[model samples]
Target chain A: MSVTTIAPPANPVERFLRTDRMPHIWCPGCGIGTTVNCFTRALIDAKIDLDHLAIVSGIGCSGRVAGYVRLDSFHTTHGRAIPFATGLKLANPKLQVVVYSGDGDLAAIGGNHLIHAARRNVDLKVICVNNLIYAMTGGQTAPTTPGQVVTSTNPYGTFDTSFNLPHLVEAAGAVYVARWTTYHVRQLSRAIAEIFQKPGFSFIEIISPCPTLYQRRNKMGDGLDTMKYYKEKSKVKNGAPTSEVGLDKQGEIIVGKFVDRARPDYRELMVNQMHESLGSRFIDPVAAECEEGEPQGCEEGLCS
Target chain B: MNADPRGVLSGTHFLDGDHACCEGALAAGARFSAGYPITPSTEIVERFSSRIPTVGGTFIQMEDELAASIAIQGAVWGGAKAFTVTSGPGFSLMMEHIGYAVMTETPCVFIDVQRGGPSTGLPTLPAQSDMMQARWGSHGDYSLIALSPNSPQECFDLTITAFNLSERYRTPVMLMMDEVVGHMTEKVVIPEADKIEVEPRRHTKKSPAEFLPYEPAEDGVPEMVHAGEGFRFHVTGLTHDERGYPSMTPQTQDKLVRRLRSKIDGANRQIGLYEAEGLDDAEVVVVSYGITSRVAQRAIELARVRGIRVGKLRLITVWPFPEQLIRTLAKRVTAFVVPELNLGQVVLEIERSAGSHAHTISVPHAGGNVHRPEQILDAILEAAK
Candidate 1:
């Protein structure tokens, strides 16, 4: 029997994107572009209104994504995109807030915000591009950089151990946690599509290659070479542990969905709690006598 | 009693500096506060968190100082005057974002109730060591408006003034208090809130669609529109254009940086808020701020009774440095006595502002104890003789 392969529908959403800016700032072989492509595709696939979406990012090469996007964007201070995005989400819950940051941004300096947002299960999507080095700062050590990896700050070999991204997100109680590399473009795109559709704090850590920084220093050569390496090494698994996935100089890369569950979103919980506490305040009473009173500044309007 | 402008009730109440700062912020029309509790400043957050919810506002205890500072900025962008309070270590963490706020022209307030520092030096003790740091702690060459309140009442009053200055200039205003002022309790008369003059943030008269986030107006103050207002604006830490996009050209960078620096510096006359006591005929003047200013005031009074011609110049706004006032005061006073909890932080500014004409003395201390009035009085008598 003959089988037919279908192409992705001519993405009508490309009209909303700045295609001219592409082949974005990521190194040619870097996985960040694939992840970004997937994200843009997911936004298109979900049919989210570009005008109503706000992309917030912190300092790093990956953080620069906000600038290239054709939407309301905020390229904020280093390690602060998550909280800034959190404020944006809380201030206007109707706005779709997405945080795009690097491993050093979300895992190191911004670790506290990452974990707390997950714990609160804020209704936002966080796309953490894990390049395993401080790419923008000339390949310095990052929280996710593997032990003994050589970089600008740790030329003699880093003594620091790497963070297990999926485990950390799960431990932080994120409602959705997924892991994918740039090599698996279709799968990463699908994961993003599904994550964006689900509510609560959805976290996806994209294991991207930083050819100019991490790759060159580690003798990983150029971008295409790194992409080839990712394609050869990554295994798209669902529940595999980081410990089970060994990091070999030329070995397998573990990538896939790790956790997905239904959980109460932050805004919904906040509104529900408000109604419970302020009972009649939220709902009009049917058997109450009406009386004239001084005009009160609407409190509900303030939240928006 | 004078009619209050902010509607604060008239009543004498004993309150700590942290509580006073919170009250002051509320009276100033600050509808948002984001902060993480640290030594000496935790009470401010605790008080604000409970009070803000009742006043149709919001208070968030952010994960850390960086988050707190960014959250405050977000709140400001969400159309509410905002503030965050921290101390020593937290202040260090907030410096970068503070610089971002300055560059982006976001109007907000930061209350740094300084303890001994370098790194968490005597977290619960009073120290004026952050004075110079407050002026230049942020990474870039930018002007800042920082106020030092000497007492709980002033803490309440200056916090309101800090918000006003921040709004007027479209810059982050710092309220530099100390452990002494933060923790000390005193009788503060809560004037009818209406008696307090509140400065509403200047928003563009233009429709949100036409608002330019960083264009300077005639008075150097720009109008702001919050995010989600359908005004597509950008804010960045890098040197940015008038439209707020990052710019690499030297001329563009120069224009952006100069306007940011000059807006506050050129408005020094309006932003330089200070109190001068007995300056007309005094031979010796004590220049002090924060908790140290209280000691200076007492010292000046003591010196006057002792037949020493001593006066006081209390710096309400520490940055913009009150240079012109100090330079004018320098020409008349024989000597300047600077009493601070830190080892000569503000004294250096006083000396630089005083130039070679006046003899300047620094009465420096570094820990839990404060500079006693006698110590400053002795300096006054010595300078008088």
Candidate 2:
């Protein structure tokens, strides 16, 4: 008997990507695609049920990650990816939910949800690609763009103070917080793997390049040049207080695992509290809780 | 499919409209809800958060209505029946997601227990003012299903209907309740799990290798496969072909947008729900919905008692607006009187349906409580005259 052997895929990374949709919409020398490459690598390395993996992204260049990945993904509305993932995770706790989006979608328009998700410590992995500008809408000003940076909306140079994201998420109660650039692919991918298992809110901010508009207008050089700059300027300080980790326009970019703590995620706290309050009368509503009747030991005004 | 017995509380009980609406959601197969509570609508989620843990689902008190609205859509894509509840102001905040849901052809429910509002006008009061908003609030030329339940029982009944229609058509269904209906307590008999029919998710049967996410069946409705089901498909709010990728040509826009309308519009006849009484040779008719329907019922009784040839048409499905019925009745009736808690909303639909065949009168109220039956009676008398 003769057996036929199939040839191995030439580009291993293509297995995790929707390569047919490529050449992606990302501009030349853009760092989003590079960051996504790291993400797909991390997702593969995590070694979980690929069938149960779900990726959610908001509106932006980074939001395109959800579309490119080979998992069950959602390119949700602007600034709402966190909440959407929140619902998806709570609905099916077994889903390995990941939220990937841009800084503007996460910190600017979706800032409220960002903080509250961290505060609630919802169990999910957030990969925020901070390109320092809103690259999709023609390089507009973003909440993460460093001070005095020029964007379409800020042609006269930005006057608004940017958010210190590592500090923000830590303050908001994320269990794991890390920062990396596309230059730090190995570290970023490693953090990505770690975040998958870290319960509660886990945020990974990848400072990436927007050579098309942001770099051209600001004269920050092309993607590779910016990557070289990140290599020289980034100082890895794992375990440093997040407060000491703000990125300066011309100063060092502090990149590391800044915060990792043990705390109950939203589902854990919610389920535990529900069990404590409602006892055995309560079950996961999606499980076997469909039948209805008066409870044996009912509290006034409860579901019974 | 029948409701899961555990989620279905099969017995008669005294409950408010808000609680009944929540029960209806459970029976309809909704096991996930993301909500930020507002007056009159809070109890729906409050009860859901408690009951869902027992029945086997999850509820999150979202940071705001924006999160609440989109979160449910995410859950839907994650393979769960999901919904969110809010009032007028929260509904306004949710308009963007509603439009997104329409564009993406996601099946979910939006419960708007409306309060008086131009902008939070009456948080604790009743109003049907959102009738127009529910129809056209989301930007773009598209059609959706909107249901109005008059009593606590209908709140349960119509909520299930909303979910069924949403699943059947793969569109977001709106359950429009007023503070009056949401807060009022009454006897509601929930049926056994198997007795209640729900439209299960129309999942695609073809293997993942051959599936096109947005490709509809002959009925102009598409099948949905949840995320994590190994169906590698992309869905966006952008205009796309069957594969659900972004396509920006006017041709794509025309084909896509037209199909969005035609699905619900094509089914408008079947989708339209209303109650008709005493229209054989009636000279005048009263059209109302939600709480105003009940009030109009009272005025209708009085009008018949006074020998005014008046009839009642209570709208259950407000959108797709029972137009054929209104148009046919318009030909026979002297006039149509619309009494609403709003200044004027659904009356416009009636007028359009009536055209010049019959006079259309609107009995508008600013909506703190409800329309006084006498006010509706007076309007009927005037329209009759």
Candidate 3:
């Protein structure tokens, strides 16, 4: 018989990942990995400079993203990633900072930071992977957990109203907001790419599958079944009012670019106000002392 | 290294300890600060907010102390010297981030204008109750440098020293100021920037290929590469290896924790700073720090007039404890009288170091106010007997 020749599948995005840190802590059929794949693809599509990019994450399954990324990364303490990224972005305006974390991390313990960062319209790209449960800590109830879902903490079923994430952030003054499920990889990747072009606070919520804790406990079949359900239920309504986009248990999912508008980001507002007030004496703080050969040049290790 | 002259307010000025601390931070090349409004400490940030824009820096009033504490670390990694200011309640909120700073080896400063508190007990009053909390507040075994400033002048001078020590060691340094010193006004002479010696960050000369983020050099301190110069290094709060990647094994944890402590402990002599006076011939040696030290100075003078040979050991840097000096003095002195604004904090260290070589006496104060001179002199008189 003639010998059959086949080429190995190309994984071009491997350079963007810390392959040495793999196999990651993510379990089998977890949607976090899928979202990461889309993120890497978006970075490529956006042609973002990998050198000037930094990833910050808080405590959760998704917080491990910082450790697995082959870039300037920080795995900060619980709920503090947004403020940490805020400092990074404000300190070095040349660098693009991203805060990547989970539902419980971004919406529960970190909820205050989430709204405030958006309110400031800090130039940060925030990716919140909403798996509807605290998967890493054995499926505890998250602030975003849909109503009547059986979580570890809410075994009798969750009674409180869940957060409408897009609405919350949009109302808090985010410049761009979008929602997509893991089933919509192309759409998610495009949305992330669009975020790179936006100047102010941009947020993308990815509804992901947690097969081990969330799906297994809720008897929602397996990861594949969840994906099929997502494929069937999601309805794209671009620029739809974010107030009506709340998710519910076994309900229709509104998925699309819900909010995209313009507002001067934190830096822009700061620059304008300072320039207007100080006039001739105004100094661009971001470019101030760090440049080489300047009066306060930070190049010769002087900044510390 | 000389500081940037632009940040220096090079002249004598009447200022409070809080404002003086702010001027000191500017002169030390701190280009970024994040803080929340807190009693006694708010003036530092208030001055920084207005002063930073003109001096080419950024000062953000974060949502709370938790954000303010860690934001400074983020700025440090972004290639700027940064700090935060707070009091007891805010300092308590910052313990977790302080641990994060230790684990990541991010060099920064935390100025705690201390107030009385187990929990917000005295917001506007002076207290040194948080001294132990400064050393052991974060839930982990770690060592840090702490400086106690007794006056506005020391606030300016020691604030610069705090920044220098933090840079040299690559660890968080605490400028422990009680509300008395934080709010007290006095003449602060700010020297020219070129005259102010500042320690530069230990940036790695090695290329990205050769550099490992957590690799310690000959001095047991790692070289740093801030975010965005293409180093692409990683920093985490978890137990990590020299590569700065998390490794959860017990072996990694042991090695990391031991090194974090040993780095500062090995250089304790170089780090310990204090003023020893009249110890050559003395029966009772008084140990004190912060505002209480100033009060103790008066007590020593009074004790000397009362025919008791009293000596003073003023601790400028309190955390590394100056155990060598305490141990040496304990050998000859009849007793050690330790007075503090707190009930009994640093006195415990004196008791531990003296360990039957000398009598250890705790002149405790409940801490709504500074100790009266007679209160310490009474203790000194008792110790002499």
Could you list the chain B TM-scores for each candidate? 0.95, 0.99, 0.99
Best candidate, DockQ: 3
State how far residue B239 of model 1 sits from its true place (Å): 1.6
User: What DockQ, on C-alphas, does every prediction get?
Assistant: 0.26, 0.57, 0.78
Model 3, which residues run further than 4 Å from truth? Answer: A1-9, A294-304
Question: Model 3, A164-264: lDDT tens per residue?
Answer: 99999999999999999999999999999999999899999999999999888899989999999999999999998999999999999999999889999
lDDT per residue, candidate 2, B1-385, as tens digits?
7877777999999999999999999999888999997987999999998788777877888889999999998888877899999999999999999999999999999999989888978999999888888889989999999999999999999999999999999899999999999998999999999999988889989999889898889988888887767786777776888888777899999988999999999998889898988889789999888888888899999988999988888889998678888899999899999998989889998999999999999999988998789999999989878
- Model 2 ranges off by over 4 Å: A1-9, A285-304
Model 2 global lDDT (CA atoms, 0 to 1): 0.87
For candidate 2, write residues A170-248 as lDDT tens digits: 9999999999998999999889989888888999999988899888898878888898999999999999899888776
* lDDT per model vs. reference: 0.79, 0.87, 0.92
Could you tell me which 10 consecutive residues in candidate 3 chain B have the lowest summed lDDT? Answer: B319-328
A62-168 per-residue lDDT for model 1 (tens digits) = 88887776667788988899888877676555567888888999989889898998988988888999888898778898888887788898899888667887788
lDDT of 2 at B18: 95
Candidate 1 docks at the CAPRI level of acceptable
Better of 2 and 3 by TM-score: 3
In angstroms and one decimal each, the interface RMSD of every candidate reads 5.8, 1.5, 0.8
Report the error of model 3 at residue A70, Å: 0.7
* Model 2 complex DockQ against the native: 0.57
